[model samples]
Target: MIDKQIIDSFKNLIDGLDVDEVYKKAIVDFMDTYDGNNTNEFYSMLVAVSGLLVELKDLRIVEHGYNLIEEESEKTQDELDSIIRQFKDLNDGKLPPDPMVSTLEEDQVTD
Candidate 1:
C-alpha cells in the first residue's frame, strides 16, 4: 500500500533542503512531547513538514527521513563552524570571551 518512490522522492527533497538544524530541533521537540498518536493540528503539521516524519513507515520513507536527518546534521555542523570562525581574530589571534564593559573612566580618557 505504501509507495516506495514517493517516500524516496520526499527524502531526496528534504535532504537537499537548507533547513536541517531547525528541522532537527523541531523534530526532537515534537518527539519529546509526542504521544505516538496525532490528535493536535500542531503535531500533524510538524510531521507533515518533514519527509522522514510523514504519516508513513515504509522503507522508502525511512530512507528519506534518514537522509533528511543526515543533511540537517551536516548543515548544523557547518553553521557552527562558520560561527566559530567568525569570532576568531586573524591578525591578533584573540576573541572576546565575554561581554565588554565600559566605564566612565574609559570614556573620559578617550575624551
Candidate 2:
C-alpha cells in the first residue's frame, strides 16, 4: 500500500542513520585503494567483515557498533603504548627493538 519510492527512501534513511561523515570517508578511501584483481584477499576480508556485522547484530550493537569498535581499538592502543614506554623506561634503550632495523652500533660492530 505504501509507495515503492517512499518505502525505499525510508529503508535508506534507516540504513544510513548510523553512517556519519567519517564512515563515508573511510568507505571512499577503502574503495579507492581496493584491488579488484585479488579475489582471494578480497573474499577473505569480505567474510571477516560480514562475520563481524552478523555478530554485532546478534549482540544488538547494530548502529553504534562501528563507533564502539574504533573507541575500543584506540583505548587498547593507548594502553599498549603506555606499557611499551614503561618497559623501555625500566630497561635500557634496547627494549624490544625492531628486528628488521640495524642500529649504527650493531652495523659498526658487524664490519
Candidate 3:
C-alpha cells in the first residue's frame, strides 16, 4: 500500500549510510509505533528521516570528494527545514493529504 511505499522510500534513501544499529532500531521502532491509518504521522517521520539522510549525505560528500555542488547542499538544507516544518504541522494536527494517495486517487478518477 501507500504506507509501505513511504517506508520503503525511507529505507532506500538511507541504503548507503553507515549509521549505527541503534539508529536503525529507532527508525524501525518509530515506523512500527505508527499504523498506516495515521498518514500524517507516517509521513512526518518519513520526512524527518529524509532530512537526516540529507544531512548524512552532506557529511559524506564533504568527507569524500563527491563533486556535490554547493547549491545542492543549500537546497538540501532548505528541504530539510521544509520537512521539519511539515512534521511540526502534522504534530499540530494539521493533517496534510498523502501525496501518493492523492496521485492514486487522481489516476483512478481519470480512469
Candidate 4:
C-alpha cells in the first residue's frame, strides 16, 4: 500500500514548480525547428539549417535518456552505506567471526 504522506509530499512538489521564460528558452529547440528561413538563397538557407541540427545533436543536457541512471546509482549507494552501518553495529565495529577458527578449535578438542 502507498503511504498517504508520500503521496501528499509528491503532490505538493508538483504544485510548487514554476515554468518561467528561462526554462522555455532552454527547450526552444525542442518546441520548434528553425529552417534558416532567414535567407532567400537556397544553399545559404541550408547552411543555417545544418548548423542548428548540429547544435541540437551536441546539446549536453535535455531530457537525455530519461536521466534516471545517475539518480538510481545515488540511491543504491545510500542503501549500501546503511547496510554497512547496520552490520558494523551488529559486529561491534569489528569484522565478523571467521568460520575456519571454529573448525580448528573443534579439531583441537577432538585431538
The deviation in Å at residue 107 for candidate 3 is 67
Across residues 73-100, which tens digit of lDDT does each residue of candidate 3 receive? 8888997787787788888989766531
lDDT of 2 by residue, 2-106 (tens): 344543453453346444455445544554465456656655654564465456556666557878999999998997787677677657755454343434485
Ranking, lDDT, top scorer first: 3, 1, 2, 4
- Go through the candidates in order and give the clash count of each: 0, 0, 0, 0
Best by TM-score: 3
**On residues 13-86, what C-alpha lDDT tens digit does candidate 4 reach at each position?**
33343434453343343223434343345335334544554465555345454467778888889977866776
Worst 10-residue lDDT window, candidate 1: 1-10
TM-scores of all candidate predictions against the true structure: 0.30, 0.31, 0.39, 0.35
Q: Evaluate model 2: give its TM-score.
A: 0.31
* RMSD, one per candidate, in order: 17.1, 18.6, 24.9, 17.9
Q: Please report, in order, the local distance difference test score of every candidate based on alpha carbons.
A: 0.57, 0.56, 0.68, 0.49
Candidate 4 least-lDDT 10 residues: 30-39
Candidate 3: list runs displaced more than 4 Å. 1-16, 63-111
- The 10-residue segment of model 3 with minimum total lDDT is 98-107
Minimal lDDT window, size 10, model 2: 1-10
